[model samples]
Target: MSTPYRFPDYQVAGDADTTVFLLHGAYGSKDYFREEIQTLVRAGLRVVAWDAPGYGISPLPPEGLSIERLAETAACLIDREGSKTNIVLGHSMGGIITPAVYAARPDKVHGIVISATAGSFSQKSAQDQETFLAERVEPLRAGNTFRDTAGAVIDSMFAPTSRGPMVDLVREVALSTPADTFCAAITAITRYQGEPNMRNVKVPALLLAGEFDQVGRPQSMQSVQQQFMPHADFVCLPDAAHYAFAEQHALFNEQVLRFIRERVLAQA
Candidate 1:
């Protein structure tokens, strides 16, 4: 049986027929979308961004968090909100869970936006996964300060021309996240495989990429779009890094609003 968790909710903004739920990546929380939420509301979207269990003020999952559990938790949250239809936008690690959300509750999500993330981690070999955890995760559990990990993650993600405040916001959120949460999330992320779930997504999807994203390359994102969501529109923001929504806020907002307007809202 699938376990259900009542994770703490963070309302970013909006009050319209459609709810746009933003899911943040590892080292991030609801605050990660702080910049883009208002713009989305202005565009007539009912926006929702939450601190997933184990992040921010939210309590850790009772049974320890996993991607499947996180996805189901989001579905339950959406069900409780009672929106007839909703749009989900996920970044980085959140992207992995977003597809699972669609697969688990296709009835709830009208559309999805995948930003700076891939569909799966099963692409890597077991040795590579182990190496990833050792290099990225072990140190956290081994007592690397939150600031240490946060700085490394933030520095690698933002482009040279990225926003100062947005970068700072992410760094702040990353510093606040508990070390345990970071470790567990990375562990779960390394083992996840979303390719199968990607195949099951019935909703329209918009794949957004950053031209200078080192973590999730534009080409990889484009490949994901071609393979999983062939019909989905792929938009890449030049001069933007991993956090394109923050680096190029206006363009990102315009593109997302247009997609939700012309594609999702028009169809859903």
Candidate 2:
């Protein structure tokens, strides 16, 4: 018999009619969505941000890290906190997991927002995948922790012009990730075949890409839209990179709220 999966630790805010589940990236926790949470709450939308397994205070799954496992956990959380109108919003690695959550529980998800991620790692060349893995894991093998590499990693995810307390907030969130978690997440992410899941997203969908995002480049996301999510709305935020939600919070929030209002809520 298998042990029941443990739900990750999460934070809830607002009491609005619509609930937005915020999932952070590889090196982030619920706190990474702090700005988004506040903004969404102020905009009258309920928000739930989670610490993906092995992140923040959440315990790692006994079965280890996999995108499927992450999707299952997210589905369970949504079942618990879901509203009449539920929107699952994910960034970077979390973005890859969003569609999987929809595949897991289509009835519960009314909308999905995939931010700063490509459709699948399978789409990348063998050399690109290897380079991605080596860049993240090599430092850990060298006895360095996420704290040691957080600054550089975070710096690379933002637009060159982006700077301020938001940058500091992102750095702090990245620093909190455990080395084991970081390594496991990078491995799981690289191995994920998400195109099938992406194609399965039948709900109202929105794709947000950072204009300067090299990690999940805007061009790649555009390709993803053409191939799998043709029905979904796509927006490339100007002057923003992988961390567009923080780098350009106002624009990011505006698009999200707009999608919910026009695409998701209007139908309701």
Candidate 3:
């Protein structure tokens, strides 16, 4: 039987019909979606943000760690919320969970927004992450700050222009996360193989990429679109990095809201 877990949770704004579920990236919490939540709520949409298992307020799962487990946890959360029609938005690692959620509960999600995140990482990225975490996780568990040890993760996650805010926010989240939980999440990512069938996704998907997001390269995102979601909408946010929403809030919100408005919200 699947275990029940409670993650750090927060509400932004709304009622039954117009609801949105927001998932943050690794080493992140519900706070990651604060700005997006506020904006969406102001526009009369109900929004929800939750920390994934092993991150933020949520308890880590047993020994086994995988994105599929996290997705199951999210599905449970959605069932609890009783949202009738909802758009799901995910950022970075959060993006990995979106498809799983869809796979678990296809009837629940009305649309999806994947920002600055790929369906999966390349072999080179896998090797790099393994090398980077070889010894750092132990130091983190021994009370060394993740901000000090995970600098490379921070550096690679943002573009030069967006580094300032990205650094600050990630540092805050990293410092707050338990060292062991961080290790588990990284392990999950290393082993995760995300959805291979972008075309199999029947729901309307909004693929928003940052012009300079190194983690999820534009080419890889485009490849996913061309190969799988040929009909899916694509938007590139100029002057943005991996954390595109933080770097270009206004444009990000505009593009996202427009997509939701034109596609999902209108149907309701």
Q: What TM-score, over all chains together, does every model reach?
A: 0.92, 0.96, 0.86
Q: Give model 1's TM-score versus the native structure.
A: 0.92
Q: On residues 155-187, what C-alpha lDDT tens digit does candidate 3 reach at each position?
A: 566667775554576557645666667787767
Model 2 clashing residue pairs (backbone) = none
Task: Output the better candidate (1/2) by lDDT.
Answer: 2
- Top candidate by lDDT: 2
The runs of at least 3 residues in candidate 2 whose Cα sits more than 4 Å from the true structure, single-residue gaps closed, are 1-4
- Backbone clash pairs in model 3 (N, Cα, C under 3 Å; residues 3+ apart or in different chains), count: 1
Clashes of each: 0, 0, 1
Candidate no. 3 TM-score? 0.86
Predicted model with the maximum TM-score = 2
- Candidate achieving higher lDDT, 1 or 3: 1
Q: Per-residue lDDT for 238 in model 1?
A: 87
Q: lDDT for each of the candidates?
A: 0.80, 0.87, 0.73
Candidate 2 vs 3: which has more TM-score:
2
